[model samples]
Target: MIALEKQLKDELKRFEAKEESIETIFIGGGTPSTVDPILYQKIFKLLKPYIKTNAEITTEANPNSATKAWLQGMYDLGVNRVSFGVQSFDQDKLKALNRAHSPKQAKIAVLTAKEIGFKNLSLDLIYNYQGDTKALLKSDIEQAFELPINHISAYELTIESGTKFASTPKVRQEDDELAFFVAKEITKHGFKHYEISNFGSYESEHNKGYWKLKDYIGVGAGAVGFLKDTRYYPSTDIDAYIKNPLKIKEESLTTDELLTERLFLGLRSNIGVDKNILNKAMKKRADFLVEKEKLFKDNNLYKNTNYFISDELVLYILG
Candidate 1:
């Protein structure tokens, strides 16, 4: 705890020096609920001054670990949002995913968070896993809506290298038809399909900050940050990061690379890309897509009609 606090304090020096205004803080990428919420008290205190008055502070938690006390502690510490890794409410699916919590635990966790005063809660659901049917996915979505959560992140299972599933890649149940069906089902319940993998009654500012390509400070081991066309990375080694949190490696992106990123990222989410950012060739392509009803023009921005084929559409426009 002491070492972590020291590292965070060291990282604060840069934000302090630049007089940067932080609008959001997401404590995620790992099981944060397992750690004592008191551990974050000092860190939040240190960051209080720089954070916006209405900052959307979020913490990711797991159903098994996020106890009522833990939820209350984080809420008291000004964490206005909590995203639970519920994945799915089906027991079979939970076992298949090797989730630590049960369906009952997930339900209880969300209810407890809501009762404890977290109005802006979100939960993630892993859909399109092996043997995931439309009925099973619908049941999961129905169970989530029964909870008090305002946002849902339903992601298709992907086999990443080094995971057990990677060895038996057939364990994945990703089909284009199933993925599209899941998106349509979620949106039918009034949640906006704001991003390809994200649906919400209310949009997530912290998540949107990423899709919008906003500059954010990333601290701690394995954290990455983006500023304009430059990307920043701290040491991935925990001991090295604790020893010198200020040591950062930088990567500068070329104009074409940055524009490509903007087009792709913007097209995949509700945040549409501005036509001004598109070149004559890109705009010409956009016009063709609009004529085909694959894209829509809203004022100056060109938005994808459906995020299901966002990748292929982006490639077509950019290529």
Candidate 2:
């Protein structure tokens, strides 16, 4: 908490100097609900000035730790949105993923947050893991609809470096067939598949900003921030960050690199990229995809018809 305060104070100074007005605040990647709500009170007070009038203040929480008191306390402190990390509602799937919370606990947490006046609620659901059957996926989707959440992030399980799953390697089941099925099922429930992994009636403005290449200040250890053509990375070491939060490594992107990012990120989400950004060759490919009914044109922007094949589409367009 003390370290976080120091970091926030430093970031606040930058905001003031740049006259930056923040539209969204997402407290995620770590279990924020585990921290006492009182810890955020001082931080919110300090940030109240720069926050926009209708800013979405979100906190990512675990189903087990986000109690009613915690939800109410944060809501009172200006947290209008809560994204719970409820990976699965099935007991076997929960155990396979090693989630601490049970199925019942996930239900209780969402209901609790909604009852406490959280207007915008979201939950994460992992699909396409090994042993994840169509029946199991359907059940998870149905259970999610029963909850009061307005958004759902249905992610495919990937075995990243140094994780326990990496050792087993058998836990991951990623394929185009399964991905399309899972995505179609979620959209059938009326949640727009806004992003490749995210589906929601209430899209995350913070996430949308990233796709649009908006600048944001990322705090804490191992956090990355983007500002125009440059990206900043603070020390990943927690102790080093607490000692000096200002020590950051910077990377400058070239015009080509930025263009590549704009294309890839834009196609992966509903945020379509401008036609003016593409060259003669890329524009031809975009037109081809449009003719094939794989891409849609909205005014001057080109968007992917299905997000499941976004990577392949990006490669073909940029090839």
Candidate 3:
């Protein structure tokens, strides 16, 4: 672990020297909270000189690993934000998803984080499970609000091609509908539906940078980085990352692809997308949507009727 910390520190210095600006740093993926707090402190100390004072430093933890002491250690080490992987509050659903923590444990984790003085806390919830009903989803949302968290990220269960669920039949359409329903319910609770799958009582400065297409540097296995107009990703292999942390494969996004990404990411916010970016056909479609009350138009931008339905609106517009 100490050796890995040293490698990470070295890589962060290299990136900072190579890139001029790095607005946010996200230390997530594969249970970062499992590492010792001292290692985190060491890493932070090394990178402190390069990062801005208001930089959003985020670390991810599984509910099972989010102990009170561990959370306190992370907070003491300069981690300002924490995101937990609490997929659901239903014990049956948790079991089906092969989660490690129970519903009670998940609640305890959130309470512990609050008790440990974490102001910017976020919880992850999964929706659209097979056999999941609206009542169950509502219960989940109610439980999320019960926590002192300001942010909630609700994700629709998707079956990827290589996953075990890919070969097995599961609820896809039902989950999509349930995701929408959950979004609406949460928005009514005073949380701002900021992104397609992210909700918060207040805006997330860290994520706002990403949605605004600002530069960020990610360090870890399979981590991605974006600076200026170029993007790159590290090898997914853990062994490769440990050996050669600087070996990043670069990829260039085309002009049209960049414009499409900007439009797509922008529409996810309540801020809406610029009307000038849309073609004549898209503008016509937007007019029809606005007339149907499915969309709201303010000046040169078009937004979803409910900011929570940004995903559905994006699909409708892009389709």
Cα-based TM-score, every candidate: 0.95, 0.96, 0.86
| Shift in Å, residue 119, candidate 3 | 0.7
Per-residue CA lDDT of candidate 3, range 231-283, in tens? 87877798877777767788888876666676677777765778887778777
Find the candidate with the highest lDDT and give its number: 2
Worst 10 residues of 2 by lDDT: 11-20
Residue pairs whose backbone atoms clash in candidate 2: none
Each prediction's whole-model lDDT (CA): 0.87, 0.88, 0.77
What TM value does model 1 have? Answer: 0.95
Give candidate 1 misplaced runs (Cα > 4 Å): 1-20
Q: What are the per-residue Cα lDDT tens digits for candidate 1 across 102-205?
A: 99999999999999988699999987788989899989989999988889999888888978788888778658898888888888989999998999988999
Sort by TM-score, best first: what order?
A: 2, 1, 3
What's model 2's overall lDDT?
Answer: 0.88
Residues 76-169 of candidate 2: C-alpha lDDT, one tens digit per residue: 9999999999998999889889889999999999999999989899999998789888888999999999999899999888888877888998
Task: Give per-residue lDDT, candidate 2, residue 31.
Answer: 87
